[model samples]
Target: MDTEFELFDDDKSDVNAPPSYHAVSMSSISADSVQCEPSFVFSKAQTKQIRTTVLSLIRGMVITPDFILSSVGPTLDACATSLPAAEFTDILQESNIEGHTPLYWAIVNKRPEVLSAFHKFITAYKNDSFHDVRLACMVTNDHTLFTKLSLTSARLHKMERTLNLSLGCADEIQVYEGDTENQFTAKMQITMFQTRIRVVQKLRMEFIAQGRIWGLLFHVGDDTRWEASIYLSKHSLPARPKALLTVEAQNEQHQVLKKEFKLKEGCFLAASEYTNFSIRTCTSTSASLGSWPIFNDTIYMDSNGTLHAKLDVALQ
Candidate 1:
């Protein structure tokens, strides 16, 4: 049987504790008096000790994995630079009290901090080749029915919410909520056809002359290559029915790379069929569309600062 580590409620829990490279200083107030919580330091030796303790606790089912993960989230972040990925990965793979993997727990519970730590671990240890691990995390043999139900529920809920937000609003210009310059913005994820599509809506971008616009990142087939789409509101500008739609990317030094598409038939820009507008910076290094960096955040402001455009992202 694995030994279970005790949780200390008060200061001096670990009296005479030796110092180490990384330590968490905590304070606790007792009923009788105020007391400083004992500092628990984690060094190389301490890490090994912690690994043994955690594995034992997990196997013994004395403490829940989620609770343990949540408790040590900060520790993981602090040690990310120093700890090897394989070591941390082994630690996280231990099943939780509920028999769920750490990745699944992080995703289902929406534990952003833990999830971030996991991402860092994967990036460092797996070198961005975690697709197989991701697939494994999504599957479990013990609870097929429950997992299927959860997935169905999530999918339906997302579709229902999208439908609610997008109904009767297609092609209509809506003001971006957060700021003044964003007169148009919409984010959507469409997954009906097994295709992952991310849409970015930008309105009145500084470079563009005050018009409702859109951009898309499409991931289809098996390759990492993704195609982009640009669209302009059809009914938007009454006076100027058509205009040149130019999308440009900039380097760190602000050098512009430009691509242009023509707008016609009351539509300033259509899908890639009409023209190809390349936004070079919108590509990602990952094969999975969900891992693509384009969806991270796209907010741009021109030199003069008079006009601005914010990207609204959707993943399908």
Candidate 2:
């Protein structure tokens, strides 16, 4: 036998190894490879501290992103309770960085909870003066959420109801000169409704005539009437100088509705040396009537029964 020993790599095994050493190695490897969880988890004491800080900030009226983020829940509650009705109005008037108010932000964010709080505030404030309330109601469409909120809050329901009634009861009226036909025919029309009614009641018209003219007044039922006045100038001018024709309507109580004027045919020489000839309809209260000058011209009536020129003037 040879004195030198031959070493075999495959035979190198520790048959008596203990299992505890292997278990320790595996546990150490797992501990090293595992990732630590995120840090958003709040402890009980930390949560209390956050809530307290938020309440204090809200009470102090500190509205900042850092403040809000730190105490969003409590601050939101405080705004709903203390800042809604009165403070919210001030916030609305004060524009934010985006040229918008808290209400605008609530609308943009679609924050129903915040919107509901503001809606309640608006309804209560509007009760003292409905004008601002009506304006606010019309100001934006974000009120859909507010309306839903109103259904739940008794206070808002009343405010919205009154606004609806006010909008419904308003009425207005408008009037204008229809058209003229070759210094022969003139017509006027009136439109009435809530927003324009008061303005319409102050209307008046003054007609300046250059010659003898015919006038007619027609009253279309519903207490509305149309008036036409005509006149001629005394000069045999080559071209007709423009004439001013005016028409006005009065309200139900005989108050002027609206005054409108139109420039019609050019001034003509008066039929006589008297220098001035004019005529106005006496049937200011009549509903249906018609008038035409001695000159030949086509006449058409508008929806309001005001006469308008349908063809060019024909000098006979």
Candidate 3:
């Protein structure tokens, strides 16, 4: 009974769902809408043109953040606009003959201001070079820079698919915040990750939202298939009437899969203190494990066997 595990101090849900607990059909689980056309292929000359323009953008010895944000990003955007979405995304992730990408150079050069400038540029298409650029960030040894870029990468992935490859939680933990015009969207990330293997594992990540204390407790051990259980120390304020909880992770194919829980009705019972609301059970929801989930038993692991999980609660 840790006082700081305050979010769900009163939660008493079990690892196994009770007969009274209704397991909603997994209908909402599906791929995010992405229209991929096979016909959008780039010509050899066009690919070379894009690369040449990009390499020239960063050719100068001293690169300024302002130049990168204004000139480089816009120029890159124009290139992407001219091509099909799939082809443009693929080229954005490519390197020049020198074996380096614009992203890799931008980060390695330490132009901190220019990182988030590409947020829009990266998210507009399906770019999968996040983790690769992160490996290049290590040379700077700037944890703050590392953290900012880590968040930028997560934001680019937009919640469902996220990976944080910073040195460790040893440095200050970074929080990614989002809220709607209506209620609130409280997000949590297992910045630390692992792969599916026949072994027991455990981890913890603590974060703050609007000056309140919160945490995610994780346990990885599988009875049948590889399984994991993630528990948030608490839920939204008892005042909020209902909530929708969403959790997700990437798969072998790099597609982000999402599963949600509606915390209302019999599922989310509320009372004066902090009744047995559905969101709490959803929070206490036993993780299915792997690139994981109760959503699907698949987890995204880096070259090293670490797992990454993303959870967010929208109060309604």
Candidate 4:
């Protein structure tokens, strides 16, 4: 933070006198002047005029190009005023000077008012351009704008819909085989955690309703012994908890295939012929697998039955 005042030598001060009685003077003062500078004042009518001018210019930039040249000062002052909620999406979506949007000017000038107006406009329109507005808001660290946009029901719905649709389209799951030296390595990437969990739950329920066991291979280690589990019903499954896996070492590799299981009650029984192996040496071959009941990724089964991998199509 910078200050407006400057320090100067006070030549009139009596250095030897008591501190309370000491006098000080600066070089630039007029000795007879006893008044301070007049404060700035604007009449209500003037203030209204200024706001109208500024808002008009802003609106013009959005709906037309005639006001671009005269928008600078008025737009700034309007930002400094308390005005009615205004929509500037048109400006963001339409106004461009050689590829530069009005948002560019707003950020460059550090105009929170302009940015806020734009944010409100974007949220209302629920346009694809909201992404750009979001990025700009983040870059500017505009808390008010960010919060407003983030809390919009439309925006939230858009995000959820996108995640669900992507999950539905997921196609490939490849379990990378590692070397024997790195048998414990099980890399996991759960791109959309909540969505993926929901999909898995739906799949488990569908399998149980049909009296079929959901054959899932939980990779244990280099030991080639695995087991399969069967889910009995959806209501029996445990509520999915928040889960995150960002590293290979964090994966819990318990190679087992259970049968006749209830999700809520946990695995009921394990398959008699279980086989587990080191993920690194399982097999280089990648298989074309089916989509999970609710998610899009194709499920790939490794030759060694030790690892399972899914390619994230949601991100694409």
Which numbered prediction scores highest in TM-score against the true structure?
3
Which parts of model 4 have CA positions greater than 4 angstroms off?
1-89, 96-100, 107-117, 120-122, 125-128, 131-251, 254-316
Report the lDDT tens digits of candidate 2 across residue range 165-191: 464422111122234433432233322
- In terms of lDDT, the poorest run of 10 residues in model 1 is 200-209
Q: Pick the candidate with the highest lDDT.
A: 3
Model 2 worst lDDT run, 10 consecutive residues: 1-10
Task: Report the candidate with higher lDDT, 2 versus 4.
Answer: 4
Error of 4 at 176 (Å): 24
Off by over 4 Å in 1: 1-70, 73-85, 90-101, 116-215, 218-227, 230-301, 304-316
C-alpha lDDT (0 to 100) for residue 197 of candidate 1: 29
The runs of at least 3 residues in candidate 2 whose Cα sits more than 4 Å from the true structure, single-residue gaps closed, are 1-77, 80-85, 111-113, 123-316
C-alpha lDDT of residue 276 in model 3: 45
Across 22-85, the per-residue lDDT of candidate 4 in tens digits comes to 1212111122221112213556674444343433344333323223434444443334333333
RMSD of candidate 2 to the truth, in angstroms, is: 30.1
* lDDT, candidate 1, 184-230, per-residue tens: 23322222211112332211111112332233333342544443334
